[model samples]
Target chain A: MILATSLAIAAMFAAGAYLMLKRDLIRLIAGMILIGNAANLFIMASGLRRGAAPILPLDEPTADPLVQAMVLTAIVISFATAALALALVYRVYISHYSVDLSRLSAAEEQQAERDEPMTEDLRESVRDDTDGEASPDGRHAREAAIR
Target chain B: MIAVPIAVLWFGGFVLAVLDGTRKPAAWLSVAVLTSAILSTMALGITVYQDGPMSLAVGGWSLGVGITLRVDMLSIVFALLSQGVLLAALIYEVVNGVGARIYPAVVLFMGLGLTGLVFTGDAFNFYVFFEISMISAYVLVSYGESPRQFRAAFVFITVNLLGSVFFLIGISAIYHTTGFLDMYRIRDQMPLVQENPAILSATIIFVAFSIKLGLFPFHFWLPAVYTGTRPSVAAILSGALANIGTYGLIRFGADIFPRELRQAAPVLIALGTASIIYGAIQALSRHATNEVLAYSAIGQVGYILIALGIGGPAGYAAAVLYTVLNSTNKALLFLSGSLRGWLAGAAFAIGAFSVAGVPPASGFLGKMALFQVGIAEDRPMLVALIFLGGALSFVYMFQLYRRRTAEIEAHGSSPWGAQVVVVMLALVILGIGVWPDPLLNLVERAALSLPEAQVP
Candidate 1:
């Protein structure tokens, strides 16, 4: 049982880490849940013992009830965090229409660019600064530079 | 009693949660609740200082069996600091007019979490309170619900949730090894634990707090969150939320894992120095006022870590004093930075001076305490680092002040009466700086509460 629990924890944590590294917001939250579960399992496995239930009149060795209680509390906290994360992600989707982290950031950069109070003439001047590096064969690149 | 403030905040928060926080009556009620909570916390501090630490084990269970709530000078000082910041932020928001209905309740809930975290003697209970505060912070971070705030909230929640996981793992490891959930009992058992596991848990716990403090290696999430949020929320985050990092470091490192702390002092000092340099250089280059203050916060926490690395009664006191002074200064700056007018400008200037460690402000006393720590440790390098950090802060702060005052001159001042609130906060910081004796004695007494860190 101990070996199995340890293996499970390792697998869950590895999976969580992998998911967390992904660029999608949904996967990131899934990763959080997985890691949270792994922590909960760790707390439970930390106090494992072959014993009877911890109740009023236990004649045999009892399991560590404290760890069980703590795990339960941790689970509740993680659940709330996940719920909150989902809500925030939904809000993000509403505003940006995307769940991809990289895309979201790119949009934010564009918005920041738009928010800047630059005159069209100043922008043209700045764009002209990069004219030397503009690709000769690429119309898209030239247009982007001109803009 | 220690429970009084927690109870007041908890019940007040519950009652306030149901009412409309945007209404004047509800806002005034929150102010009243916060006032009572602050008074109770002060009373608790007085009682604990006069008598030693006061403790209560829930349900009358024997030692190590039930959850314990303990309040000593250390807890009360942090409690007062956090609550004071919350109160000021709450009033500032109220005076400006609350935009959201849940703002008052959320601030009260945060107060409950901070007070409970400070007063708890149980390890698990600490995590519970920590979560309470973090969850409230998550909501508060998105209070404006703007695109910038949403992105900030996402980053804040994601990074902080990871930190929370690390903290939980450390707590479980400690419990598995020590076989006790009570912090005092764990401290007693810590010396007997194997060095490898103890070190593992200590490292995990340290990383968790360092992430929260926005120390050099773990500070990626701080600047974005601080700059993206509204100013009062920023004040709350910097002033109240960040206290968890300092308090956790002091309590966990100084008390529970003294041996590990001593072993890691060199690493602490190195990381702290990096944080100082990195934060200062970033602040100097940043043009936005809030962004500069955010990076400056990253720099200020380094002083706390450096003091902790210096470890002794004097060093611990220095850490505590610096944490208190820095929280007030940050709150003042973030608050006043949002307001316009001459009074707000003066408040921001005082806050800027405080950060730069000028006299006639509380920040100078904090710097003096750190200087004493460096001298006592006979580390001239540390003294030199402090001097350089101060010089960098002075330059950035001067730039921020000049830009802000110039903006105020161009535009008219802020709404009526808000500047008065900010100037009053500045006066408090200046008052403490001028009359440093009482605050110094309190911090010294708080430091003595920690178990002595054995010198290597």
Candidate 2:
């Protein structure tokens, strides 16, 4: 039983990690769920003991109930987290018309693009100064220099 | 008496959650709740200082069976710090008028969450309260309802969830090894555990917190979130939310896993050095106020890590003091940087100077504490690094201040109430720097709360 549970947890974690590497928002969320469940399973496995249920009258060695309670709490937290993630993804899709992480990054990339002209003008001026002081032909005058 | 702070926050948070936070009355009501929570926390702190750590078992269960609500000097200090920052940010947001309907309620819940997590003695309960705060933060990140904010929220949520998982795994491992869920019991049982599992769990917990702290290696999500969020949210993130990482590290590392912390000191110092240098360079290269401050936040946390690495009474005291002062500095900077007018600019300059470790600001004392630790430890390289980091910060902060001054006329003036909050925060920073002895003793006393780190 222990071997099976451990293998199952490892497999879930592996698949979850693989999915988390994808750019698709839905896939990323799926990966989150998978890994969350894996952690829950691992928690359960941590306190494994084959015995009677922990109930009122104790006549024998009982299985640890604490890990079970912890797993349940973790499950609820992750459920809420997944729900929040899904809502955020929907909001992103509404705003950007896409669920891809790369697509979401395009807006930021464009903002950076808007700042490029200033840097380019500075680089050109610096290169002009280098031509006067040292040699423009000098290698490594400024790696940022425009040709 | 033990549960008053959490009770006020939790009940207040729920009642406020149903109201429109954008309404003026609701906003002030939330403020009232937070103020009351702060007062109660201070009352608790007074009793704690007079006597000793106070504790309560929920439902009156025996030691290990039921969850514990522990209020030690360390937790009280953190609770006060978190609640104070939240109040400042809340009032600032309210004075500016909340844009979102849920802002005030979310901030209240964040207060409750921070207070709960710090006060809890059970590991699992800590995770539960940690989630409460993180979820509030997730909502807070997207407060502006813009594409930029949503994108930033996505990055923040995804990365931090992984950190949460790491923390959960570490807790489970600790339980498996120690056979106890309560922190005090776990601390007692930890040393008897085998070296391998103890070190493994400790390392996992360390990585989890370092991610939260946005140290050198795990800092990718920070700049995006801080830049995307509003100023009040940024202040809360750095000043209030980041305390989780600091407090968690001190509590779990120095308190529970002293041997492991001793073993990991070199790694902590190395990472701290890397974080300081990386953050400084990044801040220097950035032109945006939020971007520079984001990177600066990363840099400042490095000093706290270095202090933690030093260990013992002085090291722990230095870490606690630096965190408190750093929180105030960050809150003041974020709040003041967002406002316009000459007064706001002066406030920003004060924050900038404090960050740069100049005199008559709380930040200088934080630096002095770390420097004293280095001198006592006789590590000249550490001393040199602190000086170097301070020089780098000063240059970048001067650049930011000059830019703010130049752009003062470009934008319209902000609200006076908000500016007043910024100035008040600045005054607190200055006041602390002027009278460091009491704050120093408070932090030293807080550090002495740890079992092995008592000062002679």
Candidate 3:
């Protein structure tokens, strides 16, 4: 039983690592969920004895109920984190219209470009070059900001 | 008495979570909650410092069998550090303007988490509270609701969750080997356990904290998240959140795994050196304020690691002192980096000076502590490395100041309230630097909490 539990944990970790390396946002969350479960199982597997249930009227030696409680807590925490990750990924998808990390980081670079200047100096130069009406770049900037 | 801070945070955080914290009154309430927690922690610290360690078993369960909440000099110092930092960040954010509805509540939750983790004697409770803090941090990272923030959030969560899993594994391994989840009992049984398993779990736990600290090889996510978030969030991450790493390392390494720590001292020093050089060099090359500070954050933690690596009472004291100073400097820098006034510039300079280990700033005291350790240990090379690291930091901090000066000319000064907060943090650092005896005495006592650090 111990050997089988160890193998299962190993397989889950391996798969989690593989998925975590992928670019897809959902797959990364899936990877986190898997690794989190593996950790939970690892906690459960820490109980060495296979014995009767921990109850009010104990006839014999019981399994370690502490590990059971720990695994439950671990599951709740992991579930909360995974749910947050899903919500965050969905937000990213809606904003960039793609789930790829490359796209999200591309948005980051664009934001960097937008923030690079827009200071007094750059604003002065852009104002000097453009007419009073909205320039193409100005319109594009507004659209991007709204988006 | 030990549970006052934890209970206050619990009820306060629960009440604050439902309120819209972007409003003025709610934000002030959150600040009030954090302040009370800080006061209670300090009050507890006085008791712990004068008397000794205190423990409470929840539900009146037996000490070894039931969950335990323990407070000693070490835990109280950390609890106070985390609470004080959260208070500063919360006030800074409130004064500047809270952007999110949940910002204040999340900060309170994080305070609760840090408080709980440091005070818990049970390993599993530590994990639970650690996750609470990390979960709030995820929300804090995405504060801006921008695509950039989303990317940062994604990276931060994924990377840190992996670290958490590694920590969980280490705890389970400890339990499997020792049949105890209570840290005191585990420590008692650890020697009887075979060497190999203990070392493996120790290394895993170290890796977990190293990742959290953004130590050398695992620092890829740090700059991105630190730069991507707002200044206040960045401060909380570095100032309040990073304590988990420092406190965990000292708690787990020096207290729980002394043998493993001694065995790995050389490796810790090597890694510390790499982190220092790499962080300073990278920070020097970076142009943006946040980015440079991010890299500098990576570099400063190296000193803490080295102090922990040194492994004596003095070494442990140095680790505690430097961590306190480092977190304060980080809080001041990140908070002041966004402000525009001349006062903000002074605040930033004080933070930078502290980082570079200059006099009249708490950071200098931290550096001196390490220097004392180096001299006491009689490793001349270590002293030279400290000197070199300090020089490199001075260059980068000077460069950052020069750049900030240029920008200060272009922008008007910020609000007095915000500037006041920054200046207040600067004063704390300066106060400690000028009169280091109190903090020094406190840290020495905190060090003796660990069996290995018998200072004198």
Candidate 4:
């Protein structure tokens, strides 16, 4: 039983790691779910036992129920997080038009480049040019402010 | 009374969750709820100090059988710090005009989660509260609805989920080896556990927290999240949310795994030194103010780790003091950095000076405490490292102040009311630095809550 549990955990973790490395956000969430389940299994394995029900009037040895309760709580929490992640990924898709992390980050990088002038020497130019709506620095400042 | 603070936040969160927090009344209501929560936590702190740790076992079960909610001096101190930072940030947002309807609710829920985790004595319960707070943070990270925020949220969620899994694995390993979920019971049974598993779990737990803390090696996600989010959220992330990492490290290391901490002292010191040097160098190169502060946050926690590595009563007390001081300083800087008024400039300067360990700011007290620990241990190398880290911080902070505030043409933007709040926080920090006796006594009491460290 112990051997089987260890092998199962190892397999789940391996698969999770593999999927987590994928570019797609959905795959990443799936990977997280797999890893979360692996942790749940580990909690159960901690108190693995062959026994009667954990209830009153038990005449035989009872399996440790504490770990079961913990695993249940963990599963619920993971489920909620997964839901939130899915929502966030959907939002990302809507805004960036890509679920692939590399693509999304590339878009963000371009945006950051455009906004870079809001920082240094451009600050004085932008502030002074605020009166000139046609000024490129003012345009960048307006874009930066909108964000 | 033990449950009042959490109850207030939870109930307030539920109510605000159903309302439009962008409106004035709802925002003020959230502030009032948080202020009441802070007062309750203060009362609880006094109660714990006078009567020792307050504990309640759920459902009328025996001490070891039921889940426990315990508040000691350490827990209450952290609770107060997190709650206070949250309140300040929340009010800053409210005064600035909340951008989203769910803003007040999410912040309240975060307070509930942080307070619950600090007060819980059960390990699994801690994980549950941790997730509660983390999920709210996920939503909060993307509050601005910008494309940059979306990317930042993705990275933050992915990295933190991985960290959480590692923590869960460590918890399961502890339960398997020690057969207890209650923290006090785990501490008692830890000695019986064999060396290898104990060490493995300890390492796993350390890595998990290191990720949350944005330590030198695992800090890839921190700068993006802090820079992408709005100023108030960044403040909350550094000032309030990051407490979990520091609190978890101290509680698990000094209390549950003292032997392992002792065994890994050299490693802690090495990692800490690397973090300080790396973070300082990175901040020096970053031109953006938030990015500089983000990297500075990473560097500042190294001092906490170094103090923890020193491993004595004075060391633990120093760790606590440094953490509290750093959180306030970061909060003030992040909050004031958004405003353009002269008041905001003065506030930012106070925060900058504090971070560089100058006198008349609370950060000086924190640095002094660490220097005492280093000198008392006769670890001249640690003393030298502290001096070097301080000098680098002074330079970066000076650079940041000169670039951002010196050319302030006029109150550029943001409301004067919001600017006042930032200045008020700076004053509080300056007050603490000038008269640090009360804060010092609080931290010393907190350190005493840990079982006395075994002298090597």
* Count of clashing pairs, candidate 4: 0
lDDT of 4 by residue, B1-456 (tens): 789999999999999999999999999999999999999999988999899998988776887788899999999999999999999999999998999999999999999999999999988888888888898889899988998888888889989998899999998899889888899999999999999999999999999988888887988889899988988999999999999999999999998899899999998999899999999998975667888899999999999999999988999999999999999999999998878878888899999999999989889998999999999999999999999999999988988787786556554766888999999999999999999999999999999898854343
Docking class of 1: acceptable
Q: Residue-wise lDDT of candidate 3 within B196-282, one digit each (tens)?
A: 999999999999999999999889899989988988889999998999999999999987898899999999999998998899899
Instruction: Give the per-residue lDDT digits (tens) of candidate 2, residues A41-100.
Output: 889889846478889798999878999899999999999999999999999999889999
Winner on lDDT between 1 and 3 is 1
> What is the interface RMSD, in angstroms, for predicted model 3?
2.0
> Which residue pairs in candidate 3 collide?
none
Which regions in candidate 3 have their CA more than 4 angstroms from the true location?
A: A59-61, A109-147
lDDT of 1 by residue, B72-99 (tens): 8899999999999999999998998999
> Which model scores highest in TM-score?
2
lDDT of candidate 4?
Answer: 0.90
Please give the fraction of native interface contacts (Cα pairs under 8 Å between A and B) kept by each candidate. Answer: 0.73, 0.64, 0.80, 0.77
What is the lDDT of every predicted structure here? Answer: 0.91, 0.90, 0.89, 0.90
All DockQ scores: 0.40, 0.46, 0.44, 0.47
TM-score of chain A of 2: 0.74
Candidates arranged by lDDT, highest first = 1, 2, 4, 3
Model 2, B100-200: lDDT tens digits are 98999899999988999999999989999999999999999989888888988889899899889999999999999988889999999999999999999
After the best TM-score superposition of candidate 2, give how far the Cα of residue B92 lies from its true spot, in angstroms: 0.6
User: Which residue segments of model 1 deviate by more than 4 Å?
Assistant: A1-4, A55-60, A110-147, B453-456
Between which residue pairs do clashes occur in model 2? none
